[model samples]
Target: MLIRYTPGRTGLAEGLRRAARAVLYLPTACRLARDPGYPWLNAGAVRWLDRHLAPAMVGFEWGAGRSTLFFAARVARLTTIEHKEKWRRRVAHLLARRGVGNVTLRFVPPSDDPGRPGLRPALWRELGYEPHKPEFAAYADVILDIAEASLDFVCIDGRARVACSLNSLPLLRPGGFLVLDNSEWEKYAPIFTAAAGWPRLDFENGVWRTTILRRPGGANG
Candidate 1:
């Protein structure tokens, strides 16, 4: 396993570890730079998703990008929530040009709200993300409108992912999967803790990590 970075604890050994990990991921980074259409996740996670996701499955994602395009082709229907208008439009154009018809893209931008519930203040401070961005609370809540335990898959790869994952936990049907990219970050520790009983698989490529959790017998999504 690659060593996780810890602030204020790095020394010569940690620096060397970082360099080694970067070298290990060089080829993957090069290939991804050349082909941006692929989901920007750990290769193993992508492979697992390819093997597991079925054409009849219904899905939702918190980010709209290559993943949106990738899932649009594989799933029966997909709903993507994007925070940036420009990127969402760009993805929409790609979908139109590629003749992908199964995706419903929704744009939800950040806004200031005083009372919107989300990640705790300490967690936000630790993550270096703005605590005042209340739009993510609403963005995550978009899935609430769908019937509980109806969705087959949910992927959280965008902003406020912690909030998204927590909100999404109840919407996943039993045996459904929840994919969370960038799972190595310390800020995301809460998700693993909150999803205590989920059967989890973690794919790591030294640089990037993705965690897939199977919703076993529990609450409906």
Candidate 2:
């Protein structure tokens, strides 16, 4: 298989490493090709999730992608929200191809309130993000409406990630996890402070950094 990555997007060495790792985990690669979950996750993060993400777990993700298929297989219920029509269709096809039925995918474009949060540099430093787009801003309510202490896992990897993280926190059940991808970006530092109550476990996988925050589950009797 030929692997081509843009120069600025990633360096040759890192690309080669990922290719090698993908081959090393060929079995996982195969599984991911069908339904992505633990096998393709960062080894450390996978280990933690494997030990904790029970079959009956329920999860919600801000962005729809491979993780959508990932959680669909592991949990009893999984809800993923996406703003991009193309991406949503791709994920839907993956689910249908795998014959997996546990996941629900929704299209909630950006909100249109006053400043158009996505375009507000003060609220979000990034431009043209889902949060900034009037078409994608409505997604905030999809996540915000989830009842408190209802979700077993949450992945904030979409537009307005910091804002998404803040909204996701309340839905996590005790012992639930919230995964924040691209943790290495300095712009996301506010998430750490905002989510201070959750125990943070950071892992660097190739060029990406993923931070897993665990909601404190009170001790068992």
Candidate 3:
């Protein structure tokens, strides 16, 4: 025989207490969750960082938005690149609002037009970054068509699958890290093939494929 018990006063009170705690914590959790910066990175990338590159000098995020803000807070220095003026301003404002001072946001102009070869010169100049300093810049069709080759960690959450992979390769140090989002895209298959020799971890769940590539050397790599 079984006894079916409904909530009596104490049970009801306990349930109410749990509900109250959830409600009380809801706003804070929501605030953190909705923060304009720091939306979750790919799980594999996060794990790789925790294991390998968390203590590295600095990191460059190729498409400045929420992720850039998040990474800036965690790293020693964060250089974020966005091509659109509007997004650049938004990222700047968000960083300021979040009291994040280590982030340097750059608005990279289009270089696809042969006439605009020097379009990004002013941005680098304004930032006082030497031509040799490691920097990441985004383009509509490419994550980083041009950047320094001494990058510690490169996050590719932008466009131009093949171009991004090619441009990102040189940026990594011997034991650096590279992460690419939307790896499930069929067009990026060749890029994966190119990276076959590197140590890689991948996760695909129908909608997205996140691939984390470690440069060939060192503990994390």
Candidate 4:
């Protein structure tokens, strides 16, 4: 599916404000880049997850990084999907070195064909992480192997996030959380529309927003 970004909401003021915030965040971003175990989420979101995530819960995340170690430490088990080969190997080393046994890391590279089904080129360009081009339909679809409503939480911080978010909703147990990092982007508008009734909480920061949406209804519903 070709998911187009809606640029309508991000006017000149929003652009300028984000640019200013990006400048302000440079120091902190630099520090975070050096720390491999620190999740790239806004600090408020990290605190929220620290408070809410249980030791017995199972979680899945798109884009593996320091967050892999973070979630693996907190949750009973974590399944992480990554598209980069070298990065995946590095994270795997980190997991082994740290003795984090709860994570199952999978490397699902971008599709060789840009015209492959469900590929979203526009969304990928907006993400701007194209070391190998933005064909992550298969990467996002990796979650489909897990049974529906089985996940306690799903985090979308990687490529093809809109598609990942769409794929994640049904996989979450009711009241389960869907965490979206960099939620301030206009390209992710579809998730809000698709998750219309879900209760959402935003951990807002000047540079980026981390959003959490709880699936509504009973646990089995």
Candidate 5:
């Protein structure tokens, strides 16, 4: 399932290869956690990271949990933020069992009231958080509070796209990469558009859309 990059079409083959590599690299005892249903770093995002960027210095994945263990293996340090303590604990336990040592997981309670009436209470019970409280705001605040200057790579898989975008950009070093999954979602388009100024590359329709706005030597335009 190797997809080569053609002139016009984005090569999805590399991404697939990277994903396969991640799976193969996983220990036999922990292979089941890498399945597609995992909450973090879905198959598509994993493939994209493998193809476009090298392993980063500091990697941040918002709302991605144990599902990103494979990606975590590649980076020097990974910081994963989840709003629910249950998810945090679950991911922490999984990482420990897998002997994954590089990740630091944090549980940040949400700041806004869960918009839906019944949903908030249900989620709170399920996640072991207090009911009727906003959980996402705290998550956003903690990320902003981090002292680091720039990040090598960032993956936004949480709520608050605008906040994520603002917070993430400052962390990206020059030439650093930012990957936002589910960009096709209507809410994320504005953030995507706002990122238009950066030299960008995207993979859509099973192909790469490489947009090199400013090359090393000069601007593309």
Candidate 6:
């Protein structure tokens, strides 16, 4: 069964109730260790992952940036795939400045036509993230080429999210995690169901919806 994030904020009283609950119940320590200057995953997801992602594990992400640094600190090695040269270069500089040397970044060009079904929808303005299509398909291929079951974690938070999600499923090691950010979009409903074999945890923290799906077995802590 799929767990959905539907917060019903009917009025001020109801909103305040949630706010009060958050102050009392939410775990503040699970937030990302540091602010990386961009939107990352939600707090609950961060907390869960921080507790579970051990330093010996290896990780990968479809798009790189603040997340590159974020995961690098937790995992032993991290590889990032990016389709934009400009973004890749900028992220590389930040990584260098921060002295994060364990990450490998590969810049793959957008190979597919920009127009395609399930490719682009008008979710950019509302969700602040857009799916990169044909180019994304190419990027997904690079991730698929990674040795099967070799990565301990994979994050499909960048463009071509769906394609990356499909490819990432097999690349993860048993008990590994596949994290998809901005998962509340209606268009991504299929992804949740398709990931049937894994244990899925959905988190909604007012600002973003993040889904952490695990491959079979216990999470590597």
TM match of model 2 to true structure: 0.72
Candidate lDDT (C-alpha), each: 0.80, 0.69, 0.60, 0.79, 0.55, 0.73
lDDT of 2 by residue, 64-143 (tens): 87677667767899888898889899988978898988888987665565333432333234222233334444575567
Badly placed stretches (over 4 Å) of model 4 are 1-19, 30-35, 112-134, 218-221
Q: In what order do the candidates fall by lDDT, top score first?
A: 1, 4, 6, 2, 3, 5
lDDT of 1 by residue, 94-126 (tens): 999999999999998776533334433333344
Consecutive 10-residue window with the lowest summed lDDT within model 4: 115-124
Task: Report the number of the highest-TM-score candidate.
Answer: 1
**lDDT of candidate 4 over 1-221, digit per residue (tens):** 11123356587776776567667577568858887777888787888888888899999999899788889988999999888999999999989999989999998888754433343334334444233334766777677677888999999999988878877788889879999998887888877877888888897656568899998976522
Question: Which residue pairs does candidate 4 place in steric collision?
Answer: 1-118
lDDT of 5: 0.55
Candidate 6 lDDT by residue in tens digits, 1-221 = 22332376477676766666555433432343335633377777877887887889999897887778878888899999888899999999998988989999989877764433343222332344445465555676676457778889998877767767766776778889899998988777656655676788998865458899998875442
Model 1 segments beyond 4 Å from truth?
3-18, 113-135, 217-221
lDDT of 3 by residue, 92-157 (tens): 887888788887787766553322224333323433433211222234223344465477777777
Query: How many collisions per candidate?
Result: 4, 12, 0, 1, 12, 2
> Against the true structure, whose lDDT is highest?
1
Error of model 6, residue 81, in angstroms: 1.0
Model 5 lDDT tens row, 139-191:
65456555544567777776665456555655566666666755545555555
Q: After superposition, how far is residue 200 of candidate 2 from its true place, in Å?
A: 1.0
Per-prediction TM-score to the true structure, in the order listed? 0.82, 0.72, 0.64, 0.78, 0.61, 0.73
Off by over 4 Å in 5: 1-45, 52-56, 112-135, 147-149, 204-221
